[model samples]
Target: MLEAVGLSARESAVYQALLTRPGADAARIAGDCGLAEAEVGAVLLRLVQDGLVVQSGRPTRYEATAPDVALGKLIGRQEQRLSAARLEMQRLTQMFRDAGAPGDAGQVEVVSGASAVSARVNRVYEAAHRQVRAFDRPPYMQRLGENLPLQQRRQREGVAFRTIYSRDALALPGRFQQDIELSCASGEQARVRPSLPTKLIMADESMAVVPMAMGEAFAETAYVIRSSALLAALSALFEHEWSRGVPLVAGPRRSSEQLDQPDEKTRALLGLLAGGLTDEAIARALGWSARTTQRRIAALHKELGVSTRFQAGAAARDRGWL
Candidate 1:
């Protein structure tokens, strides 16, 4: 047990003997452990440093501390030292790990290239199974890279990341700037940026990495980071950058106005639909043939990008264009 915590063989022997009989004088302790008195005293001093025993009395009598107290103290000291040692080791490990390729070591994998990188990012998006905590900087969001539009639409689907972006990414004009504005008008989260780049990806802070090489004509390299130390460092960097970002302007959206101010016929069609007008009833009421009414409803659905007329009505209602 003593050896387990790094005690010398002699130290273990002397310490064990002291425990078997706590009040044993140094001479008796030495004899009991088959050691010379001077040797016993030396080992006892070592044990003291090891927190296993202490010297008491003016004559320098050594007494063994209670096993519970001694063991607890020893283990606690060892654990503290081990924890500090591990932290230093982890820091060094991160340095080495970061220097190496971030290819999947078992379950973990690192991918590169804009398309491949977007695929990797989309894993987080599709898997959002919940919310998207977005921190989309303009340049990155607008990076006319491959598959940008599809990715942005998918990003806007959920509540989390859109707000972070709509509040921030919309301020700068470039790519998806209008989308950001549209989102902000929808009364979702969208903020403006004082400054930031087209880089950053983090989902639940469990994973986060930025492209070390961005906006280059060719190859894109992601500085994939996973270690808690590194992840924490990156998160801190994001938060610091986020703090400097501008707050989003809360105001009415122009899209709502555009959607509301349709032509009179479009408005009449929408109003009829809003009043629960079916195709047959709308056709009869508007004195239009059934085919024409269905065509108009179909066109309205196409225009609104809704699967159902109710959804169109709901969207119209949401935009206050009803």
Candidate 2:
């Protein structure tokens, strides 16, 4: 319990033993705390130097200082250190302002360690007011679950959240469907795509956290990008993928006419494409000339406002026409 105050487990045990028995010798503390006599001696020396235990009497007896007194001094020292750090931060901020280039462009930070990454994620979420766009998948920090309440609170406060999940992520060994449904119920727009380029979380289009390494196993190391052209490129990638994702939650209500009305032939064309059929095979199945089939396929692409067959299938699925 006192480890935060610079006490090791053995030191805490010896201190507690001394507190319980006012004038215990090293051997007595060792037996009581289940420590070796030599270890107890070393712990007692450290405690004495830390001012939590004092040496007294003939053979160097040990007694613990009152908890209130010892902890008060430790707290004072910590506050002094914090004050010094705050002053140093102010100095650095001013120096950067004087010497740094204008705007936040090209500013990037590589944050390592799981705890540090979690802290940065929380920091970004707290600073976001307008929108938070996220690409989420597996190999997540175990502590990521703790942020749900914060997300819900932000949703209540009118902050927009849009999340895209990989198809595999939703199929993991958990009650993910129920959890996702709950999230959607609370105003988060969600979508699913077969795969994603990377794990990303962008705040208000100004800042983003992306993996420094390629795969899920390297989730701990991340790059925090500030406003830069690179950030814009990341935003563009997200938008492109988002356009090709199937909505898991219902989007804004649209009139029936607003949804593209592709007829049965158009549906059949897309279904054949989605099934990996060749153009010739599709034409043979439909009993149409290859030229006519190609023209219809081109027309279908134009109707869906997508150039690629994959995007066409994704758009069809997103609009519930397939």
Candidate 3:
């Protein structure tokens, strides 16, 4: 444990020996700690520098400081060094900010690695005041583990939070449904679209983060965009998609009877339909033939007492089916 306070193995052993034999010299400490006299001399010097041992008298007697007092002083010194480093970091950051052109459109930052990207994301939400708009999908580097609490806390702080998810995002592994549901329950407005290109997280309309590449290269790299026309354009795109997204937990699932009538498959189909998925896309998702999917859609419409697909959607919504 003394090693944690900057003592080497020999130094800690020597200190322990000194505690047991307070006025022990190097020869005596070496005997007790199983070290050679030369080794004991070097270890004692280091322990003295670390404030764990004190030397006194002409014979250079070594004494151990009380553990509590010595460790406390060591911790205080370590904390002071840490504080100084933090101040230096802040100073360097400010200098960099001052050196940069204000509001530079070309001020795009490339963030690489999963952990780095995740940290940048957490920072964005931590500082968000007005609102957070996000486009969520798969190829995720990290789960929304840290985001859950921050969203809930921000919601309580009255910072508007909304997330738009792709239908496929819900199907990806790793507690996707539970994560989204928990956020929605915590007052985050969540919606689902059938598809979304890339991923985006925009906070307060001033900054945004988006993948530098899309589709197959989604998780490879991302960009942090500052206040610029590109940021505005991304925000506009989010709003456009938000206007088209279906609330993941909007209104209700279905009337009690209507809910009991549909199995998981039917419910999933309804959700995809409500998300505005094309039949071809739905067929691809469900691994059904086009004809089979059409039949199912017709049957679904018939079950809802609706004639056209649009009416089916309306009737479904009216019955709390979507």
Candidate 4:
């Protein structure tokens, strides 16, 4: 554990010994840590230089600094260095792509197998800084809601997420309420479309991951696209689909008394209606029975003064309800 923060095995052992027996001389530390006196003295000098230990008195007693303060600072510095390294890596990747030969295959890497594809997907999301744009559909590589916590953390860190879900994806049993709606409630900007050409995820306009196929083995192969014209085209494709998508908003839940009024659930109903979901799909998402769902639709139609469901959807949009 200490090794991750830049301490070697010997250094960690010496530090632990010092921490347990503060104000000990190098000889005592050596005996406690099972190291030679000379080695302990050298380690003590390095520790003092690193601010992990303080040496004082003629005989040179070494005292360990508070681990919370010292280790926390060390970990912070390591994180800064890692951040810098990531930036440099991006710079080098760009340079490499720019210098690629005519038919070089460096920009697009083929990641094989389900586990590899899933791991690459996670890495792409983890590395995103500014924004994440995705076209979400069925045949998921990982379990549903697996990335929810990570996405929420990124949102809290000010990273923006925009996802366009296919209508079929939203219509999956329990998917809308359990995953999509919950994500929208947690700061994800969501939209739904009747269908999507493909599933894709792009991070900060720098990288994208697209499955090679959408069959039963869709997760077995994927193309990890680095910075290139293809990546730019994929980003443009996302924008096009995003423009055509209907906004899917999940509002705060209201009391049953508020059901008579136009509320979030109503807006969600309008969105689902616009997305072309059937009555059953809508009912499942809103946790309502078929009868209740029809009653609500009837009431919505009456309120909107529209005889047809399509007209109701259009009217709601006209009135800015969806």
CA lDDT of each prediction against the hidden true structure: 0.59, 0.74, 0.76, 0.84
Residues 187-210 of candidate 4 have per-residue lDDT tens digits of 899888999999998888677889
Compared with the true structure, what per-residue lDDT tens digits does model 3 show for residues 1-322? 7666666677778888889999989999898877799988998998888888999998999899998998899888878888999999979855653433226765689988767777777766755668989998876776555568877777887888888989776654433444755675567787888789769997786667798887666566789887788888888899999998886643234457664556655765676677666787667656677998899998998899888778877887786666
- Residue-wise lDDT of candidate 1 within 1-322, one digit each (tens)? 6776677789888888877877677899888888899888888888887677887777676667777887787778789999999999979855643443233432234566767665656554444423444556434532433434444565466424533442223323333333543344444444344445546666554555566654552235565444366666666766666565434433343465375455545654665565454576556545577899889888888878897977988876665556
Best by lDDT: 4
Q: How accurate is candidate 1 locally (lDDT)?
A: 0.59
Please identify which of the two predictions, 1 or 4, would achieve the higher lDDT against the true structure: 4
Find the 10 residues in a row with the least total lDDT in model 2.
94-103
List the candidate 4 regions with Cα displacement exceeding 4 Å: 1-106, 252-261
Model 4, TM vs. native:
0.66
Ten residues in a row with the worst lDDT in model 3? 93-102
Instruction: For residues 217-261, write the lDDT of model 2, one tens digit per residue.
Output: 466788988778898898899889889876663213335775655
Spell out the clash pairs found in candidate 3: none
After superposition, the stretches of candidate 2 with alpha carbons farther than 4 Å from their true spots are 1-103, 250-322
Model 2, residue 32: displacement in angstroms?
Answer: 38
